[model samples]
Target: MNAPAPLEIIAMAFSLTTLRVDGSPTPALCVDDRYWALADIAPEVLQPEPSRGLMNVFGHWEHSEPLLVAAAERLASAPPLPAPHSLEDVLTPLQYPRKLVLTGANYYDHMRGDAGHSDWDKESKAPLFFLKPPTTTLVGPGRTVRYPEQTAKLDYEIELALVIGRKARHLTLADAMDHVAGYTVAVDLSARDWQRDPRHLVKFDLFGGKVFDDSCPLGPGIVPARYVDHDDLRLRFWLNGELKQDAHTRDMIWSIPEQLVAITEHLTLEPGDIVSTGTPAGVGLATGQWMCPGDLMEAEITGLGRLTVEITK
Candidate 1:
């Protein structure tokens, strides 16, 4: 198996999807900045089915990229092509990850408002994180986030999500990138009021506050690690069509490599594990503007595309 030449690859459906583009999943590729249906161009390569899932296309260590590049080259020389289907036309390439690990206050700006932290302006010696139930929280774009009724303050955090391709344990910072499968966008939707509530009997209210159903919205397809320019990628979050949070990945206090090294130091991360690299400032809590039912939230990063989610009760 060989890696596909540097190209931004995407996944489309050939079977049924929530939003049917061609009355079924539209198996296609976004390559060389164009769209080509896999069936039309690479029927011999593979077929799309929910059971087979996108793992064959995305999780493959060596074949995923090469297969995409071949298909893209074929489409480039082909005759008039059909218009590419919108990302909304397909389901998330990989649906749910086995583990959803979230970083906390990894961003300098985000630390200012972090709960009960006196060293908000100073850098920490190590990374901090919390785990969310993957099956309940992991969802794709176009999905409605069920606003939990227990809290009135709902918030959103836009973070660059790392997808682990192979098993990683006791990894060093120098070798961390080798374990990354790809990059995708993720929203760390939170119930701030619940997360910070001091009155709760449980000492670690952060768990209860952040682990509600539909709390983690991940997707809009994954961009293979080979194609991402991580040096200074732009990250933005919009609320109700208004730009709210904007920052660069370079500003992170703990670089992605360091974060990975810190996490894998004790815990073994398996393939398909997703670690969202914390959000920047300008969360709703900062302005006392909480999310309400019917609010539209969009989280976007430079290489990985945008993930849009609607808020509902």
Candidate 2:
């Protein structure tokens, strides 16, 4: 497996309230694994709207190359993190994404599940996908996930989410990555009771079960595409202190290129749009176990950092 580059270009969004350099919240760039806060670096390109947050940095696709170039030059010196900001201060890196597209049964093992349908074609067909309400499901690391009262079975799905840097419509497989801004780790939280009903066999609300407020937890931060090898990263999930899901990106039935082509075929993907590649096997639904209040869930990807979410009643 080819590994990610040693120099992972990471960045995040912090609560302007929490990033007060001098008793007043300021828009600053947190980079290099949150160790350095490049205060107002390329503010014209990164922080056009001083009041808005990280999405500003991602929305300007035309400026991404230049911004990343400037960021890399600044990162060379390895400046110290500012006194006012802490990792705990980080917010969901990109808030209010225009859309959240997700692939379904994209992994062979995950598709197999317990029922083990052997005839399910793994190839020769386009991927099946679904959409989720964007900001309503989005939260960052260290955020608390309220267990919805509607369902008893809460599940977790760790997926590699792509951040679209440029507008794309009817894109070919070869041109897909050119539209990607970077990548981040995402937990596609689900309430399985809404997904399927084995007893009824007729009613399945996978759409409703898949999306709920605060159901998607993303971050630690976004890693620039240059520093990542998407096809071979290790992904793992932990429940409490025990490891639950472990897999590599290479196992994906449909590659990122293929998935992107499938999505862009119908939807015009825009900057700040997120497309989450599906999760692998080992979700709670397979084991008949569910997360409870006080449970801590951790999802980690090789180059991208770990994302943690706490369960609460």
Best candidate, TM-score: 2
Cα lDDT tens digits, model 1, 1-313, are 0233333333321111122346654435554345555556655434444334444444454555566656555654765335436545545545555778889888887776544355665443667888999878877666457888888888888998888878889999889999887788889988887787778886447776899988888876666676676657899999999999999998897888888898988798877688888888889878888898899998888856678888776
lDDT of 2 by residue, 2-40 (tens): 443343332322111114344543444444344444344
Give the lDDT of residue 85 in candidate 1.
61
Candidate 1, 136: how far from true, in Å?
1.9
Model 1, which residues run further than 4 Å from truth?
Answer: 1-28, 32-50, 77-88, 113-118, 121-124, 201-203
Worst 10 residues of 2 by lDDT: 9-18
C-alpha lDDT of candidate 2 relative to the true structure: 0.74
In angstroms, how far off is 180's CA in candidate 2? Answer: 0.8
Steric clashes per prediction:
4, 0
